[model samples]
Target: MMEFTHTASFNGHCTTLPLSSNNVTLDPTVKDKWGRPALRTTFMNHPDDIATMKFFMERSMELMDAAGAIKKVGSYAENGQTGGVHLLGTCRMGNDPATSVVDRYNRSHDVPNLFMVDGGSMVTSGRGQPTMTIMALAFRAADHLIQAARRGEV
Candidate 1:
């Protein structure tokens, strides 16, 4: 007698549209222990995002059927995303201070000495992992900072 086991899984990711309403703000009524306003996050999935999640679920089911799986189970948020997995696109990067938080080099537009080289500086979340991209941005920002320091710009 012989025994064998096989398993497969599929995970799909979708790019979310940016909305001004989805943002982090300081809570006017809530204060932290340090006397600063507490951070309040407002987020809701767009209609397109919900549709994309449904599409991915359907595709995953099809793939499972095509693989002749004996049993399969899949689920997605029917209403909207309840929680976030990858936290990206918080501090958007752009050339204009009026529209974005960070500049092209990941430097804070409002604060000259502050640099944001993490996922928060991304303008949009990619459909894949952002680790490598964040690393690259950090390296680039570091290089720019070094050059700026050399020029006595800091």
Candidate 2:
């Protein structure tokens, strides 16, 4: 009997550009029970994302073959891969209000007092482990908010 293990790398930079792609719109025809317009998403994977996944899958198969596997069956493509636990980039952070929802400090551009300290503030999806980064960002935002409050800057 031969042992087989399957694993995947969780590293892909497939976010929409700040000014383009993945445009979200309020569906005027579709409404919830509360009579509020539902959000419609237009998301597509970047070409680079597909390429990277293909490369990783090929490498993994090569490794498996080297390990004396008699039969190997693996595919990164031809099968849907919804491989993300941490959804990111809903509200991106940037310096400009025209492109970003939040600023560098995770503060809303429209509302100075409103701070968004979460994964939504991330501009990129990051490499799989986003919890730690989110926590750090939260701490950083908290510290900044506290200092701003102390200085009467809201």
Candidate 3:
């Protein structure tokens, strides 16, 4: 399946570069502000991704042929992989001692007791919309942070 990793720095710098190996090529040939070959994206799908695509095409063809399709044609994934599900980058937030810049209450990691106090600190949002989860994390973190302060964990 197509998968990618993303990282965001403490300074709010984030990037989402593709990591898949699928042949789903895209010629992003253009010049950038710095006079660089902007980018030419060509993803070669992972093995599982190709397999999944093949299965889908095969099944589709069989079904169509069974239904007496006269023009039964098929093609498989050349990149050889399943496919990537849309799992975004930087969807992580927590109070981990390291790696994460935000605490459970969404506070900056390096700063002492200073909080980002924003929605970007959330770590995961499961399946539902992230808005609701971020709000919930904020509420929970606020209460817990207050309690921690009372207990001297900060």
Q: Which candidate comes out best when scored by TM-score?
A: 1
Residue 84 of model 3 has an lDDT of 37
Please, what's the RMSD in Å of model 3?
Answer: 13.7
Q: Estimate each model's TM-score.
A: 0.89, 0.81, 0.36
Kindly list the per-residue Cα lDDT of model 3 for residues 24-128, writing each as its tens digit: 233466776777766454444445545655666777777776666655556664544334333332323555756566666776677757755544554323334
lDDT of 1 by residue, 18-112 (tens): 78888999999999999999999988888988889999999999989988988787988878887767788879999999999998789999999
TM-score attained by model 2: 0.81
Q: lDDT of all the models against the reference?
A: 0.86, 0.72, 0.52
Candidate 2 vs 3: which has more TM-score: 2
Worst 10 residues of 3 by lDDT: 7-16
Superposed model 2: Cα runs more than 4 Å off:
1-19, 78-80
Model 3 / residue 80 / CA error / Å: 17
Tens-digit lDDT string for candidate 2 (1-154): 5343543333333332333475577997999789999998766666666676777777778777777666666666424346546677778889999988899889999999899888887756544567898898888889999999999999
lDDT of 1: 0.86
Name the regions of candidate 1 deviating beyond 4 angstroms.
Answer: 1-6
